[model samples]
Target: MRLYSEQRFGLVRACVARDGQPLLYAEGYALDPSLTLWGTRSVARLSAKSGRIGFLKLADGQEAMTDLSDPDAINEGAALEIEIAAEARADKLPRARLIGMADGPLRRLSGPLPLIERLKSQARRLIDPQAVFEAAEDPDALDIAEAQAIHPSFDLPGGGYLSIEPTRALIACDIDMGGAGEGMIHTPRQAAKRLNEVAVAEVARRVRLSNLAGLVVVDLIGNKHNGEKLTGLVRDAFLAESPAIACGPITRFGILEFSRPWGARPHGEDTPLKAARRLLWRAVAEARSDAGGRLKLRAPGPVADLVRQCLKDSLDPLTPRLSVETASVTEVVPVR
Candidate 1:
């Protein structure tokens, strides 16, 4: 989340250690006026080889390299340490004094130390609020355009519309026993148990697909039955979805809160199927309007090819004025 400068571009860098070694580094860039920032586009460029130091070009074309070979060159190697003389002036660039040598090979020349210092000095000013806002808003248009294609007027069970919000905390689901029946033979307790079981399964699936994490609250249908039965059902459901997720005991109000560890946060809200359909439709429309009026799409490989074949088989019979094309976006992976 911190921002720094790198050359003329703004750089956001974070220090990370791997295998007890302070080697991993995260670097991001602020978008220039012409470019739009959308979602978490920050790429974590890690060193592929051990003891190897190199620079990576961020999205904004800002360069960052580690000086692992020499400690003296602050801007030349992966190491950031440097020495200064007592008489050194504040305005002038300090002379590079060799403090120590690193135990690795030097890959490339780091940027100038004065420029690096200036970037570090103006780090606060570079962290622009406007830039974050611009980036966050860029993805909405695409999501909306995609959603419209999938469901022109899709409606949720409740009156709420589909929305994407940015938050550090994970999303939780609560199911209340609405105006359902409470019978003497079946008992309200039995109904509550069934509803709780269904809610647990559905919530788990949503968490996985949405990449939700942290605390999750699930308010089940309140019943006069034993709380132990409800707690056991929730526990079993959690285990079935993911054993790693830890859950607290059911609360007196019949609320179950749990946590799911997510490797990375989601950038957008469209499901895989919905995203693919939107992209495909947009490309078709574009291709139709082009000079040649022919459409060609780059898909992920076999899947793309299959989609293209399906499109051809379905649309070829129409014999329309424009030609539609299809291809694979990527290679197929074994279904989990």
Candidate 2:
């Protein structure tokens, strides 16, 4: 876990890579001990909507004064990590490291899961664990690191794929069963079931990784049995990650509906300009950290152009110490 410089790294994710393939990941939240539930008011002043998520306790006849300066301790994010790590480790063979984050208020992770663990309870093998605590080491990690602003599409293990979209009405995931399960099963019905099985598992994984919540509509291509099987599979899939998930019977259109808690914002709200600024800082930091290497930043056109100037204006002092480049693209990468 790490403490984020909200100004620089907007939505940071802890990514574990098995070789070059992007594996499991979790988003990072700021860990400032000084930070509190109330930003500008005391508990007594907190409105019903603005009130925090804890209870106050006192002894009989004891009257306590509201101390706006000191609020309750907050480490649930860290605690969750610790619990997840433990659960992930029961199978053994994976190692975890709290790298880059120093012992201070900036630490963001808390958990027992090590460097690697089985991707899930049903996976046959454990993954080689490695977290992106600092900066992304490759283009894939950088690209898939954060999901809030990421494209909704995700590739499955076989040939099928998913396109996730957060629509105004609900979160929609359309599964296009490609050749992935074609040759694996002989009959069309069998192939549909095969793809349905694979799609359900992957959809569950994607939902958790992307932290996509609320009314979710999944469109799968298959028959009634295939849809029914998929509905059960999805329920079982989210049983651990989100037990509160409510899945119902599939419709004639092969749509499965379910809802999960909107625990937190999947991605922090960062304007493109802010993202551009952070990219510039990343480039400079990378360059400085590496005395002679050049760090190239690939981002959308507007962001690249904006950061190019940021490098020109604010980063002048570090010019001699750093070598950086920014390339423009059509899509924006939240962070690298």
| Each prediction's number of clashing residue pairs | 17, 17
What digit string (tens of lDDT, one per residue) describes model 2 on residues 143-205? Answer: 454542345476766677878877656888888877766666557777667767776776666
The sequence of per-residue lDDT tens digits that candidate 1 reaches over residues 32-100 is 221111111223222222344433333334333333353233333233222221111212221222234
Work out how many backbone clashes candidate 2 has. Answer: 17
Against the reference, the lDDT scores of all candidates come to: 0.37, 0.46
- Model 1, position 323, has a per-residue lDDT of 31
Q: Of the candidates shown, which would achieve the greatest TM-score relative to the real structure?
A: 2
Q: What TM-score would each prediction reach against the true structure?
A: 0.36, 0.50
